[model samples]
Target: MKFAALMRSAALVTAVALIPATTATMAQVDGRAGPEFAKLFAVFQRVKASYVEPVEDDVLIRGAIDGMLAALDPHSAYLDGGDLQRLETMIDGNYSGLGLSVVMEDGAVKVVSPFRGSPADNAGIKAGDFITHLDGTLIYGGSLDDAVAQMRGPSGTSIRLTIFRPGRDEPLEVEVTRGVIELEPVTHELGAGNIGVITVNEFSADVGADVFSAWQDIRKEAAGRVNGLVLDLRNNPGGSLDESVALADLFLTEGRIVSQRGRARGETILYDAETHYRGDMAEGVPVIVLINAGSASASEIVAGALQDHRRALVMGERSFGKGSVQSLLPLGPDAALKLTTARYFTPSGKSVQEGGIKPDIAVPQISDPDFALRQKYQTRESDLRGHLINEIGIKDEEMESDSIADPRFQLTADELKDQGVEDFQLHYAMETLRRTTASTVALRPAKR
Candidate 1:
């Protein structure tokens, strides 16, 4: 099994999948738990001996393991043959399938987001689209793992998808051919006014280095000093913790990046800036970070760190709140225990478990015609079954409450489309940077 921390927030249904953590040794149970173990064994024996159908020992054992983990939190799970294989494939960063990230919402397979250039994205399988069938077979109320297995196949293969979009009148039938999903973790572009836009798709391996290289390339392309930067992390479910700290370190000169606190001795860790990189790479350049309901885990770490330090002006909807860390304990060569071992906090000692990282500026995605409908169905960490509760109590009503409306955002989707504004959030961020004098948005030198 991969001996790394799997910090990606949302559950992935595509070939790109969740990561695993460090190996852990099984601890001895206390004598006080003997009665509970005895009862479990009794139930196991009764099911095996008296059931009409003979139940396999492994099946029962697996079920018990799954139930135990599920009771704790949604992120914890038992990973065996197929699950471990998927983890390996995700780590490898390439596979053949309709690239998508999905989660099981009340037994229905709901699309989180399609990988940027994958077959699903190309075929218009958007986030919030409920996939009810695969190849005309009803998949509602089915296992997410089974549905994912059905969706993936050899490259060049095609599968029919029955999608139920939230505001659509009827279910749409679409056929998409599977292709190789090789996700580029970091992608950059030079927009107007020498503004460099760096989009971190995921916190995969060496993503910090990639972003540094991207900045260099953007500077070269501009042939002059870059005025501002937009770090786009919208729809980005996270990855490695190390990568997140590294990415945040690029723009921060000093101070704590994030701190992990857990019950275990070694689980509590403090990550700070200047440990990975020497100093701020974009020292005096202004930065604006973009996030939405889809940005989570490692993504939140970067956003929270930068926001707390006033390194960037975070704009967009509330993020997908996921502050816990999952450590993969190797049970065997083919299996491991993906357990939530710690809850992480931002530099200001804020936990983004239930409430998530609130943006410095709340900019709605009014570019989608179904924005209201999509927002209604959009799921976050708090929406998941058995999610970790925040240490500081955060009410559900408060988290669900809409941000105050701004008259500046009164433009309709149709109007924006006619005006050639493909992405409203990006447009707003770019426009804000463009209009601002460079000094106002420039990074303040670190105190320490």
Candidate 2:
């Protein structure tokens, strides 16, 4: 299809909030800052004149640009060359590599998560793994885009990755064969009790359309009206703002899905149901959204909207709060400015800035033995240095706590295994659907 240039506010923030692209050029430095500029220039002159080795102008300029944006927020950045290309590739969603969503932290390339069935995931790559090297060559201290470019190659090739995983005794190496990554935005699987598990891997272009198609397929396989749904948004770093809104609109017959506010005239906009899709596709079916720390940005938009509207009961851990939106304002042919232009709010007027969407039902995944370890090391938008704080202040405890006590999810990992619950979170969601009537599916004690 069809596509448009949108924002990817990332480093866990990845919702390309929809806004009209402006022809506005970067304004000239103000006369008021002439003194400041002179001082900076003076420093530059001294360095160039007195330093033993000469420093290039491009190097100094790039450093200054990066430094300015870095101090603003973790998401804002100056994009050029490979950085811009990588962003284009994310939106395009088709490439050659062991597919993974990654970010740079403290000068190391960290795995946000592997695409569910990509070569990376197939090779047993897990989220939170720090990729230390590629093919025995150290990649730490390099730019994230450079690391990403090195990992990619033509299909059928193999690359060795040296990973340093937290809670592990030693670093590990994994060999993943290259594959052409076809970024299918949505995937569905029909589980027991006629439960449709629809996973939104990313908010790439036409993700709403993809989910609609997925629902149709699930229903066809179901051979009847699906009783319930589990919208899996786990490990989704995020993508297109239109796709996120469109996806939420599919399940909301009427209501505000999300709203973005910014100082600029173009940044303020509201998305509502029927604005993109006609009506609720899964209107009557009870819905449970699956999210975790990896779920962010556009992921939070959908979860927050559905949760606020009572259209779906959200489950799993707290989402990676990344409510801000980025806008790609072209600086020139070779470079662009990726700026955090707006902050989004949910239907209930709650801002998922540093505090992400909280699931109505807190269900933990006790299936993976590494689950506890992952939680300890899991990163979120709030965890990022220089991340924007919510306008409405929040306490540290609110962001830190995952769950209190819930007897329903009190089952141990071994207990869940005994019940053949390989995926504890999804199983719990589906089981809840099977056991409860849709109207009374609240997060209270189980009814007799």
Candidate 3:
């Protein structure tokens, strides 16, 4: 994503008040919106004249702007100076915070997913948990920015969170210390039998280059030529769309990677492979992509593209369905508008809006004792209010199929722990790749 680059230009913020217009011209332009405009002005005048106390024009104007956008969708928002700086910081610098991706849902701050290895993640903050209070203060019906600000503090400082988990009977209280969140966008490991595991935490700047370098490092650290590859995107909340394209292009040679359709001409664009990278990075290696409820946006883009082309076997829980693309339109020097501009589609013309990417092999993280409980309450894009609906309707049954327990995957966490399997999903994926030979792996597209 060119989020940082988009902040350089100044954009015009359209206001409700018009300069001067004839009644007929205004009627022709806005389909007789004079009465609607009159109502809005009347409300503003009444609110200004009669209230508990006098409210500042700045506050009222900002509230009006926020209310207008709130009526449209959840993703669209007015970003003030702090919001812009925070977005930039998340992309390029480190900050001391709980390191959790959260969104306001019905005025409650709900955790999307905690960053892997962050303080919140270590504190056992799971996705779909609603944070009700911070430091003993009830934060219900508060702005998301304020809740986020309260959660962030200097390193080593502790904050108490009152969380209302869905299935739990009582509200859970947990204390967590803050730390500097140094986002490791791309991480790699050399597994046994010359298997390489590249875990993409987020699609930030230079992620494609980082993954390429990771493959080099894994090859150097390996005992023999690389036999298998695993691209782990679990709990990755996504970032730059361009980086997602670049990452997918690393493995794909030639095909439509993704396409975005929007009202504007510029928003509609088609991305293909052999553009960012020349050829497949791991040409003949058996590949598997791991995703879960926390994988969204750019993560879904990469997973959907790879799965559509049959480049990798996607194995994990269904992804967080987020097909819409948000474009950062700079409002001024210190503010911006993050507006949902387009909906992206996979190569198969599939929109992962409400119904997220379904894994080819549904593998639960049975290594965690709380897997069943967490999975039951796991939130996806469909859980968000005013979220974009898929152009094609989604079946309730389609979304529930992954939750069904399979006899082959009935191993309990304690049983897996006794067998030394800390992560059952990854362990299973690596094992599947190990037994497969290079000759059996198809680097080219299979016949339809």
RMSD per prediction, one decimal? 3.4, 4.0, 5.1
Error of 2 at 194 (Å): 1.4
Worst 10 residues of 1 by lDDT: 8-17
TM-score of 3: 0.90
Any runs in candidate 2 off by more than 4 Å, and if so which?
1-13, 17-25, 275-277, 399-407, 410-419, 442-448
Per residue, candidate 2 scores C-alpha lDDT tens digits across 309-403 of 78788999888889899876555455667789999999888999888988887777888877878778777777799999988788658665754
* Tens-digit per-residue lDDT, 197-308, candidate 3: 9999877778889998998898788854988999999988887787788889998888898998888557788988874455888887888999998888889999999999
Clashing pairs in 1: none
lDDT of 1 by residue, 1-448 (tens): 3334222322231112233334433455688999999999999999999999999999999889878988998888777766666656765667899998777777899997898989999998888799999999999997888998999999999999999998778999999999998878889999989999999987777889999999999999998689899999999888788888888999887899999888876888898888445688877788999999989888999999998888888999899999988765556456666778889999999999988899888998999787988887777888788888898789878865765678998999999999999799999999989999756665464364
| Number of the candidate with higher TM-score, 1 or 2 | 1
- Candidate 1 Cα misplacement greater than 4 A, ranges: 1-27, 167-169, 399-403, 443-448
Give the clash count for each candidate: 0, 3, 1
* lDDT of residue 311 for candidate 3: 85
Report, for every candidate in turn, its global Cα lDDT versus the true structure: 0.83, 0.81, 0.81
CA RMSD (A), model 2 = 4.0
